[model samples]
Target: MEEQRVNELKDPSASKKDELLKRRKKQVGGAQGDSSGTASQGEISPEEAAEQAAVMRSQIHLFWGNMLFERSQIECKLGLHDWKKNLDVAVERFKLAGASEADISTVLKNHCSNEEAAAGHEKKVEDPISNVVDKGDN
Candidate 1:
């Protein structure tokens, strides 16, 4: 009996195909959290919802990039490598970015490196921000 079940699973023409199709139908139909296995009465179609999600994902990516760049600049200015302490300062500068504290911490922990922070400190000490503008005046 077990061997027969295995063979049926391997055969696309078997009743297993119908079962799989029914499961998929249930999942897609109830995606809107309706109890009746149908979309909410006024909910948008699946394709339109997926498109909006994609757009939101891209926007979030851009915002994350901009926030990281600004944080790097501030770290260079402060000549510090301790990003955990400076996160609040960075968050203040990026107040309009709309990122949550948890998201900012996750991004920093994943992407920010000690080497980059060290490089920022080195650049700040060697050149200094004031000297750069002064040099531009010449």
Candidate 2:
């Protein structure tokens, strides 16, 4: 009976394909929490809207690139040394591409190593006790 039930199950790929389709549909329909409408709904004039859009776009670009670099650094600190080097290279690329020092620092704050940070810098890990498991047989 179990074998029959398993055989009767839908193909995993089909569900995955459906999920991809749904994601595409959502993207096309202006995904939830998207501020495109909110930006347009304001009493601001078209010129103001255009300026706001440009500013938002710039912010998003910086944010996305920073996120990628910081994630790479975290991966490196967790023993992925190669990823760390790659992230450093990416940061250099950003600097060469004219990314502001403030932007770089803000993004890196979350992932910097003790040695990478200045004196008196420390990372505080919230919920450290959650990592401990009580394996005592009671």
Candidate 3:
């Protein structure tokens, strides 16, 4: 159930995120503002642009989520570290697999940590402390 919730937060549909990103890309890059105050390269309105920008802003989590999806194989290949689990390896894999700093941070701190902890294999047990037994005078 928790996994389902996380997945839902991450938005499992790549295309939905992609479409938003693609539109954002066009808006930020290709869809430049017209000096003459008219739609130029794209037919998107200012209101639409604003809306897309807002949606894209909200959807930024998707970018990192998508990055995780892309690098999951590479991350798996790096395997886990005793101390850090696979996160360090995963982050490196992500970098090698072409993720940005922002992407790495988001993936590690946001998408992966809870899942890793909840998986329960990595639980650290506290070391047993020695008890000082008092010797009573006979």
* Models ranked on lDDT: 1, 2, 3
lDDT tens digits, residue span 64-128, model 2: 55566767867766877677665676567556444657655654565556455554333334234
Cα deviation in Å at residue 4, candidate 1? 63
Lowest lDDT 10-residue stretch of candidate 2: 5-14
- At residue 123, candidate 1 shows an lDDT of 88
Ranking by TM-score: 2, 1, 3
State every prediction's TM-score relative to the real structure: 0.30, 0.36, 0.27
What is the clash count of model 2? 0
Looking at model 1, which ten-residue stretch has the lowest summed lDDT?
8-17
- Report the number of clashing residue pairs per model: 0, 0, 0
User: Where does model 1 exceed 4 Å of error?
Assistant: 1-41, 81-138
lDDT of each: 0.54, 0.52, 0.51
- The digit string of per-residue lDDT tens for model 3 on 13-85 reads 4344567567767765644554655545556678667766655554554455455554553554456334253
